[model samples]
Target: MPSVLWVSLFMWSYQKLASVYPRERPLLLLRVSGEVVEVDEKLSDLPGLVNTSPYEKGWLIKVKLSNSGELNSLMDDDKYSKFCEGNH
Candidate 1:
């Protein structure tokens, strides 16, 4: 039987949503703005893709935006990199 290892909570539009963590890694808190439309099933079986090909094969889910306005608050890749640098 399959057992859950960990669960994480994230906020979207002030609502809380629970996401399951199937691997042994740090929990990532993400601010999401949409409804999940698809999940990458291969990640459950091949967790290494998360490290080996995160930008390509390791994507976890696909979402359809619930509110396009939320895009206004997001950071671009360059800004996100700078933000992460400052935080670290």
Candidate 2:
């Protein structure tokens, strides 16, 4: 069998119009659609997420981000690093 990357949301748009919409729980919202799997190292340059030069593309959602605010709550790169470091 082909080795799939095990993406949560397959070919989902980056930042969607709904992104601008107000959300209550971002993580919970993300799980609503597909399983909130591991986020990719690079962005797919898909339709939604305007594509930032992060790695390959600006991939935002591996799973569905139901609540708009959920995304907002996520920490920035620096904060995220801290979060990961603390957890590990």
Best by TM-score: 1
Question: Which segments of model 1 are wrong by more than 4 Å?
Answer: 1-30
Query: Cα lDDT of all candidates, in order?
Result: 0.50, 0.37
Candidate 1: tens digits of C-alpha lDDT, residues 39-81: 6778677766755775677665666666656555656556666
Per-residue C-alpha lDDT of model 2 across residues 1-88, encoded as one tens digit per residue:
2122222222222322343223322231321333555654333324333333332344443444445444444444576556657878
TM-score quality measure for candidate 2: 0.28
Q: Which sections of candidate 2 miss by over 4 Å?
A: 1-55, 58-66
Error of 2 at 13 (Å): 18
**In terms of lDDT, which candidate is strongest?**
1
